[model samples]
Target: MADNLTKYREKRDLKKTAVPSGGASVKSSNGRRFAIQKHDSTRLHYDLRLELDGVFKSCAATKGPSLDPQDKRLAVEVEDQPLDYGDFEGTIPKELYGGGTVLLWDRGYWEPELNKSPEQALAKATSSSLLEGTGCTVFVLVRMRGNEDEKRTNCS
Candidate 1:
């Protein structure tokens, strides 16, 4: 892996937690990807993972992803995870670090609009302290049930 998943590996014991101790990166025909997971730990939370630097940059949203434009959910940044962790879905034993079940909510590639390149967009966000959740307006779209429609939502 281009990024050392030290924290990711250090957090859990493979013998106890179902979470993987990831190593080495895989190349997919698909481009940069992202995954949203429903994590039932100490409290229920939705995790957002963006593929970057060969690792999954993570964030946690307690209220989950919003489908309304006016909603600005609180998202706090978390440690990076292994890219393979995107596929993880199972129960971590009660004695484990994150002791609970995990569900994969969504997984897909991201399409950036602001900068000429995806890298540039990431760079811009980082340089402006946006990646650190400073002056950052994160917009996410989720297709709600009943009607297939898109809505803009922000996270900080």
Candidate 2:
């Protein structure tokens, strides 16, 4: 039930910003895709996006991903960005909503370790290790709420 970038478009001025307006630039791969963007906004943080139903479910990882396995990171769920956002690497004007340097840290397809669809898994938030490998790197994304504490793991 993706909103097709309705909320994403509302916050951005398509005519003034360089961010990709939701279009047909969706990933052509067979598996679901994911992206990690290192954003230097008012503050620096990592944004993680998982593609499902043609839109990316986005979140801000406060401390980025952890490798200690014992550490739990805080990820705040944000708006759904267009799937094409996976390839975006640029600087949004300071006057823009997410004004900052956005670097495409990583991008690849992922496999879900769930019994249901990704959209359903996200809504249920029941998967401990939501996603498997992003190319060769393996990471975990525990379902997160708007401002809730979520755990992410990187074992690459």
lDDT of each: 0.66, 0.74
Q: By TM-score, who's the top model here?
A: 2
Stretches of candidate 1 off by over 4 Å are: 24-27, 116-155
Looking at candidate 2, the ten consecutive residues that score lowest on lDDT are 147-156
> What is the per-residue lDDT of model 2 for residues 59-156, given as tens digits with 9 covering 90 to 100?
78768766567787777768889988888999999988999999987777665655766666566554544445443276765654333443543212
Q: How many backbone clashes does candidate 2 have?
A: 0
Q: Taking the tens digit of each residue's C-alpha lDDT, what string does model 1 give over 1-156?
A: 634677777777876666867754556736677778899999999988777778887777898765566986666667788888888999998778888899997776665444435555443332211221212234443312222352422224
Return the TM-score for candidate 1, rounded to 2 decimals.
Answer: 0.73
lDDT of 2 at 89: 95
